[model samples]
Structure formats: C-alpha cells, structure tokens
Target: MNASRLTDHTGYWMRMVSNAVSQEFARKVAGQDVTVAEWSFMRALYDLEPVPPSVLAEKMGMTKGAISKLAERLLAKGLVVRTENKDDKRAHSLSLTNEGRDKIPVLAALADENDAEFFDTLTREEHETLNRILKILAERRGLDATPVD
Candidate 1:
C-alpha cells in the first residue's frame, strides 16, 4: 500500500515550526521562573485587576479549577495576591502584586524576543501578512481561547 509522507501535510510543517518556537519560548520563560501557562494567566490578570478567579477562568476560557491552580502558583511565588471579598467570607479576588506588575513588561519583552527569534527571518510585509492570515483563520475557526498550552 502507498502512504502519504508526513511532510506532505501542512500541519506537519506547522508543527515542526511551532514545536521549536514553543520549546525555545518555554526555556526563555523558565529562566524567569514562570511557566508559559503562568505567564498567560498573569497577563490576563493584569488586565482584569482584582478579579475573581471565576471571572478570570471565564475570560481565559479555562476551568475555575485551572484558574485556582494558576492562582495558587502565582501566590506562592509572591507574584499575585488574593483578597477576600468584603461581602462574602468564602469569596476572594486575585490581583498581581507589585512585583508581578513589574514583571509583566519584562515577560512581554521576552515574548517579543521569542517571536523575533522564530519569525525575524520573514520580511516585515511577510510578517504582517502571516499575522493577518493567522488571525483570520483563528476567527473563522472560533479559536477564541487564550493559548495556555
């Protein structure tokens, strides 16, 4: 029987580039003492200051349990703080600590560097076109979730 080679698929090619890009970024963030998921969570929380984990979970398209887990990790690292709701003893909200707020730009810079490492080979026009195509694909596919993995 004849078989199609793996490299004949566009997904295979995309994955080859994606895995290398992702692995390098993972290494970059590891040096900053945060996982990619944590970075994503922190970046989300940065925008929704003092928000409940439930809200964060919704915004991130993540489970509440997942949000809680990320919150726990961030809290342990002193990068986030959880505050009890005044009206409800069992309810709480999460927010970035001063240190975490400070780290956002630094982490963002690392993300920029990572993108450059992988995509700088593309001409500026090519890069913009690639971004437009990816965005269109993402929108059409309803792939709206924040990419944590």
Candidate 2:
C-alpha cells in the first residue's frame, strides 16, 4: 500500500495561499468594523438595492438565516435600512443607507489594496492564468458561494 503526502497535492498549496490571503484581508477589513462575511453581504447590496433578504441569500449563496444576521448587524451600524414591501406587507426589502453607499468605495479600495499586496508579485499573465484556472474550477465544481470566510 502506498500513501501520498499532503505536499504532493496541488490543493494543499492552493489552500495555503488562499488561507494566507483571506487572513490578511480579514485583518484589513476588521479595521473598518466589518468582518469578511459582512463585507461580502454589503458588497452584494452595493449594486442591487431594495432587494428582499431571500434574494440576497440566493445571490450570496448563503442561507436566509445568515443574511438575516448580517442584515441585523448592518442595521445596527446604520449601514442599511429595511423597508416594508408595499405590495406585500408581510415582506421587507433591504437597501443600503447613504452611509453604507459611502463606505462601499472605501471598502472596495481596501479590497484592491489587499489583492495587490497578495498577488502583485505575479506577472500579468500569471495573475490572469491563476484567475482563469480558479474560475474554471469554480464553474466545474458549481461553487458559487462568495468567499466570506
């Protein structure tokens, strides 16, 4: 019987790099009083406003409960507003407040900085190749969840 070492797997290397990148970005975003999960949630709302939480959950590939928890946090932070759906009194739609809209650019800048800091060492072709490969794998595996963790 033969067993392969962990280092023999490409997945090991990918995970190592991914974990480092995510951890660093987590630390950077923490300074803005938001977790990476919250950042993902807010980013989703940056474009599609006045959407129901169920729609958000589907877009983010997260559970409705998770969206609710994140919504509560953003609501408390004055970053989002929940309004009743006029057509359906039992339903509510969530939208980013002015403060939330203002903070998106700032948070996006942080994301840009984080990516540059992590992947800037690669050449342009290498960067593109890496992204292409990741996208292919994601599509093949049907992994659509935003990397909130």
Candidate 3:
C-alpha cells in the first residue's frame, strides 16, 4: 500500500496560502482593534445599513446568534446604533455610527494594503486568473462573499 505525502493535497497548499494571507490581514486590522471577521461584518453593513439583524444574517450567511453577538460587540464599541421601530415593538434596525462610517475607508485601506502585500508578487494576468478561478470556485460552491471562510 502507498500513501500520499501531506503536501500532495490541494487543500494543504490552499490552507498554507490562506493562513498566511489571513494572519497578516488579521494583524493589520488588529491595529484598528478589529478582527477580520468584524471587519468583514462592518464592510458588509457598510453596503447595506438600516437593515434588520435577520436580513444581515441572511446576507452574510451567518446565523442570527452570530450576528447578534457581533452586533452587541459593535454596539458596545459605539460603532453602531440600533433604532427601534415606532410601530413595531419587536422590530429594530441597525446602522453605523458616524465614527464607524468614518473608519470604513481607513479599514478598507488596510485591507487593500494587505492584499497588495501578499498578492502583488503575482503578475497582473496571474492575479486576474487566480481571482477568477477563486470566484468560480466560490460560485459553484454556493459560498457567500462574507469572508468567513
């Protein structure tokens, strides 16, 4: 019988690259006192605000409990505000505070910087091909773009 080496798997190599990229980005965003998941959450909300937690959960492919927990942390950080609907006692929505909105661009810059640091090694065509391949994999796998991988 013969067994393949650990590096023989595609997932092994993908994980190697992913861990490096993710860890570096996590460090860069840590300077902002935000985790990568939190950054992803905030970035998603930046595009769709005044949204209910349920809707956000669906859009981010996260559970309601997870969204609630993230929301609580962001709320405690004074980065977001929740507004209760006047006509519905159980209905509420969230939006970013001015500070949170202001930080979006700065956080986004950090994200961009992180990408350049890791991916700039690839030539333009190589980068494009890699991204296209990844996107195709994501689409075929029904993966959301929520950055939770």
Candidate 4:
C-alpha cells in the first residue's frame, strides 16, 4: 500500500480498537449505574479531599465547564458534594461523599475486569508494550498523566 493508504488503514484500525474497548467497558459498567466518564471523575476524587473544579480540569485534561457538568450529575446522584472553597470565597471545591467514596473500589474492580476481558488475549509482554506505546502517545498528545478526576 502507498504511505497515505497505510496511514489511513492504521487509523481505521485504531478507531475500531478504541471504540471496542470503550463500548465494552461502558457495558460492563452499566450495572453500576455509572458511565465511564462518571466513573473516571469519581476515581479522580478518590483519596483526595475537596478539590477545585479547575484542579480537576487540569488533572482530568478536561475543561472546567465539563468538570462542573460532571460534578453536577454526580451531585444529583449523591455521589459527590460541592462546597465553597474555604480559602477562595468565590471558587468551589468538590469531593466524593461517603457513598461515593465507598463506590470507588467497586468501579475499580469493574475497570479491572473490563481490561482483563478485552486484553486477556495479549501476552503479558504484549500488554506491557501496548501500555508503553499508549503512554508515549498520551505524552505526545499532551494528555494528562494524572488519573481522571
């Protein structure tokens, strides 16, 4: 194949793999009544005290508006609490509620299962190589290395 054609072919395969992974994880998580994105946000809040939405945005590689929206949904679900920042009168901070905190391990388990289900075909070495490549891509793309909050 020509170089351009090869690039196009690889891109298509990349999207196919990505979509499959994402969809499968979403399906696995449906039982928990949480979307992948919501779970990501909750996982980010795990182990941390109240944090500003801006910090979440930076850590999650999302916009403050998007974080706020996610927080709103989490709040409605009683999974997170948003409160005024003690130090910053105008800014708000968010943290997981007791219920939300308790759900992190469950979601993490689901995530682990999701990975195992999809990537189990790969040998340990292959999985490690894939992880290394993906990490490189994330850095190249300027993506956040921090876990999604």
* Residue pairs of candidate 3 with colliding backbone atoms: none
Q: Lowest-lDDT window of 10 residues in candidate 2?
A: 99-108
All candidates' TM-scores? 0.96, 0.96, 0.96, 0.86
Once model 4 is optimally superposed onto the true structure by TM-score, how far is the C-alpha of residue 78 displaced, in angstroms?
0.2
Candidate 1 lDDT by residue in tens digits, 30-64: 99999999999999999998999999999999999
Ranking 2 against 3 by lDDT, winner? 2
Preferred candidate (lDDT higher): 1 or 3: 1
TM-score of 3: 0.96
**Which portions of model 2 miss their true places by more than 4 Å?**
none
How well is each residue in 38-79 modelled by candidate 3, as lDDT tens digits?
888888889999899999999998999998999998899888
Per-candidate Cα lDDT values, in order, are 0.94, 0.93, 0.90, 0.84
For candidate 4, the lDDT comes to 0.84
Model 1 pairs whose backbones collide: none
State which candidate, 1 or 4, has the greater TM-score: 1
**How would you encode candidate 2's per-residue C-alpha lDDT over 1-149 as one tens digit per residue?**
99999999999999999999999999998999988898899999988998999999999999999999999999999999999988989999999999988889988999999999999999999999999999999999999988788
lDDT winner: 1
Native-to-model Cα distance after best TM-score fit, residue 46 in candidate 4, in Å: 1.2
